[model samples]
Target: MITEKFRRQLRTEAKLWQTEGLIDDYLYQQLSERYQFDALEKTASSRFITILISLGGILLGLGIITFVSANWQQWSREVKALLLLTLFIGVNTSGFYFWRQQNTLSNTTNKKQKLGYGLLIFGALILGANIALMAQMFHIGGSPYGLYIVWGLGVLVMAYSLQLASLGVMAILLIGLGYLMGLSAVFYPGEFSWLQFIIEYMSLVAVLLFIPLAYWCNSRIIFFLATLIILLALEISLFRIFDFLNHGLWGAIALTLPPALLWGYDDIILPKVNSRIFQAFTRNLAIWYLSIGFFFLSFRAIWQDFILVNYSEISSEIHWLTLVEVLVFVGLTIWEWLCLARPNKRDAQSWRLDLVSGVILSFIVGTAILCFWHLSINEIPEIATFIINIEMFLLAAGLIRIGLARGIRGTFWGGLVLLTLQIVSRTFEYNTGLLLKSFVFILCGVGVIAAGLWYERHLSLEEVRK
Candidate 1:
């Protein structure tokens, strides 16, 4: 009998031949026998070099910081920031110089080729730092708009120079954080304002601009970048709806919301986005309706009353969203159905486990709802909604278990999606008092940390397998 290990090796071999366009019955049999045998060594060498380059960049950066800080007694804050910035400039300049040198080095020996790769890696790191510093210097931290400008330069330049996904990842992450910070400021205002939030969106616009560039260059990093940016932009727009209308309702929309919907468009947007994966970020078709109508309906209410429950503040005759909300919901439901019709590769990968977990959790929720629905009859389906909301807390616990047992990326991401829903569900949620809210938060914290232990166990198992 072929052991699982041997079968896996055969599968790897088959994949290799297919990639090489030498796929045939005989080639298949040859791969099933044994691989080229040098694949592991070649892969290991590449990985080792990648690690060295990454680690060296980190250590060098830290060393520079240490050396400069040790002389802080002689250097001012401006001087320190400038010195750090200059160090980054030097590193990036070296990268620029080395890239030119590569043409000449291409004819060199294997050792020289390895050195070229290392230099390229080092150069990429330097370029990353340079863009980051430039962003910082340009007021990335002080102003919301500044963040976008800096990130724009960083992301665009990094994609062009190294085609590194991590650089793109960093850009997307910063964009997400910028959106989060902007939203938090909007709801909990001190110095942060709508202008700053708009600035955050400006960076999003920049992301849109560069995604095409990344794609034209044939970088897969662009696809993920587009994904992150699209999801993030939709999230920000949704949060704006909350601030403009009902914060709690916004949370509702955020929770039940599907990410693919945010990036869904087939006839025009779909073909356009799909044509260039990097530029394919889409907005849920219903979103166009939801955001515009939501803004108009809630704007006066938010500006005039500040408190939603004080119906006395507004004229009953001047209802803004009389039937719009119903239509929006209907449209959203249809959009979600469309997305479910043609689920992405991620959805297909673990649909069985997802369905199983979802069904079980649904059963659990249905029972819980039956138990609690009578008490919450004062609320409509919103009660079932609330129960469903809390079930996310429980669902995450189960996903942690699945992620551990199955070693599936789908389970891991699914769990995180559920967790995000749980948090989004609670934003500006009706709070009876500090005490109740405190208990609820305690439950959330404890539950997540408990689930994290399972994740840690999964990591341990992975280590053992390695």
Candidate 2:
């Protein structure tokens, strides 16, 4: 997406180009019309006003809430219920009215629209309060998380009705909050609420509920949050059910599975749906996952623990739920891989361009083999450490290469940071002298500056060529 700042800069440059006779009036007009240069100032002003109004509304709402809360106990149930209903209806009605208001000769600004959106958001917050107050009035009792879940569901319905991304994001946060809080109740023996069912299969719920909404709203934020929720839910399920298994296996799966899914998201998941909107996000997340995972693995202490852990004490009994969940995701991944490979697009140049994916796949395989070796045969800690260090270095180098090839600054810097961190971490981790540490730090600093300058120059050249 072209940002407002970029558009503004382009507008200035276009004006300069026109003044210098580099571009004629027609071309300049085309650029102006396409970028809506004339409306930028108006849009900025509208946004500023909207922020001010929203802030004021928040303060006013807080005051009203505080006043109501102070005298809440003095009111009769009938009066209280009536007041709540009236407040909810009145606010939402006003919001809807303003939201649908047309701009007339007398009203040129988007203040009404902004005000309506803010009110709608405020009304949504009021919804949760109303639920809590009504419940309190009737003395209906359940877990706090259950209340949040219900509140979230209500907001979600509102989001669906209005197709508002803000409300959708709010709903996801509320539901996520409830889900996290409900984790405590999962292990506690207590009376079951229907919400327990939602908590149990939150991954499925998040996918079914939010994924469609994400596509409907065309919101990357929603998609990102939904993806994270699903991944976290699945990971939690695995840990909860498979806690009796070897920790090494858990570590291996945790390290490898997410990156694999994310790295192949475009190829495996998007093709079926015929959309690549989230490909970049998934790939970046995969890179981050691998980078962090490899950083941890590069430590000798972690490998020492892996080699020392007794696998024989682990339970052989299986939990069907966890097994099915694992099998489903693993099977899906494998099936998708096969489908992706069925096409005859495997050329040398294609392979070279996809060296990042190749490296990730190799890392996954290598990790699995390492874990299995530790389980099945005796292994040297140093050897494992050395192998992990090599893998980490390769990953960093791959990131740098890919970044340079693709001209992505973030990717390049990510790789640089990872490489620098590795060097520094190793320096501190090993029995090195102060002089050696100082020397290493200085070398890393110089290397970083040099690399950054070169990359910036490369980007400038690319831009010029374009």
Candidate 3:
């Protein structure tokens, strides 16, 4: 009830019990805590600024996507192509600009918030454009193989000028593969009429061109050459499948397959990945590919001899021997899956899904047998396939959402794996035309929803509103 001035004077007088303490632990500790908090408070402000800047970048990216999609369909094909080319150039330009800006890492020390923010904005815009271009191309009519060329050139430009050499080389190789596989389709109407060109003239030329460059400039060119060679071998195998190659030479083909698979290793995929983690991962995959390919080739060579007595039935799949082959294949798959999935799936690159895919593929080898054995797949089960794809797509989308939401790498890897499996599934599926296309849209919607929910959970309404 006393006056405020009187109370303050009373408190000060009462606390003056010891104005100067001799090495008091409590006072020293209190001083230290206050100093620590003062420093922490400064850090907190910087963090807040960073968060705001990141949110701004994300919003800008989404805005670009929304803008493009809103007006996309109204644009013509040539414009779309030009837009994609422009996007590619934009990305490369942004990367090089950032590299130049960030070189020597001194800008951050100099407190150049303006340069940093500018880089982020430009990079986010370029990324948005690239993604939009890819999305448009995904549904675009005619061949998409041409777009791959544009992407390759962009990567090349990014790598040399910006020093992202490994990624650049990797991208170039993928585009090179696209060109090799789809070139005939690009030039010819249908069928691989220029198969020999890929095998003889083209692939060798690529090896000659890329391998030496990798040696001198980047050493990652080995991966490019190796993968291209492996692709060449794969193309050869596909051609052999169509021509019904003689059973006698299957043994030789099986033995020689390992060499083609050697490129599946770090020597091939690592430089493209260009990280210790990725190199190890790719090496593991290479080993797996080699071991599995070896086993299948060896086992098939043995199986081929047993089926020679009724080769015609073997070709048509009425043979009892074909059933035995199926049993062996399934047994191997189950064993492989168990081994791969055991002890909590220690292997990051488990090929279990691919193995399952292979089993289904082998079953499809003889369509008559499949119709007699399992009819759900032989005659297009549109609704069921659609539902399954939906579930799979949801799961993939969920996992990616969770990963990206929490900034976890595992979730990204899982999402990418699921996408790969989906790609494989769709590749094998016979055309259901519009139904399949519609299913893809629904799956993409699920992914969009999941991503939105994750982002919304993390970002405040006010932050997003801007």
Q: Of the candidates shown, which would achieve the greatest lDDT relative to the real structure?
A: 2
Q: Please rank every candidate by lDDT, starting with the best.
A: 2, 1, 3
lDDT of the candidates, in the order given: 0.50, 0.79, 0.45
- Per-residue CA lDDT of model 1 for 157-233, tens digit only, reads 66566665555555555655565555544334455444553443443464455455555465655555664555455
Higher-lDDT candidate of 1 and 3: 1
Per-candidate clashes, comma-separated: 3, 0, 0
Among all windows of 10 consecutive residues in model 3, the one with the lowest summed lDDT is 367-376
Per-residue alpha-carbon lDDT of model 2 for 104-170, expressed as tens digits? 3232435677678888998999999999989998999888998899999999998998899999999
lDDT of 2 at 249: 70
TM-score rank, highest first? Answer: 2, 1, 3
Q: Of models 2 and 3, which has the larger lDDT?
A: 2
Candidate 1 Cα RMSD (Å):
13.8
Q: What is the lDDT of candidate 3?
A: 0.45
Write candidate 3's Cα lDDT for 1-466 as tens digits.
3232443454344335335554355655564343332443465579789888989979998998799789889988777778776765665455445445542222232224344434533543454356546566666443445545445544444444434445446545655765665644422334333332333233344444454345335454445455455445444432233224434333233332333233222332324544433243333344344333323322222232432332332232222332333234334334543543344345566444343333323322322232222222233333323433554555456556656655655555556556555654464454557767777767766765675566556555545765
List ranges where model 1 is wrong by over 4 Å.
1-86, 97-152, 188-207, 217-222, 246-263, 266-379, 382-466
In lDDT terms, how accurate is model 1? 0.50
For model 2, how big is the CA root-mean-square deviation? Answer: 5.8
Error of 2 at 317 (Å): 9.9
TM-score of each: 0.40, 0.79, 0.37
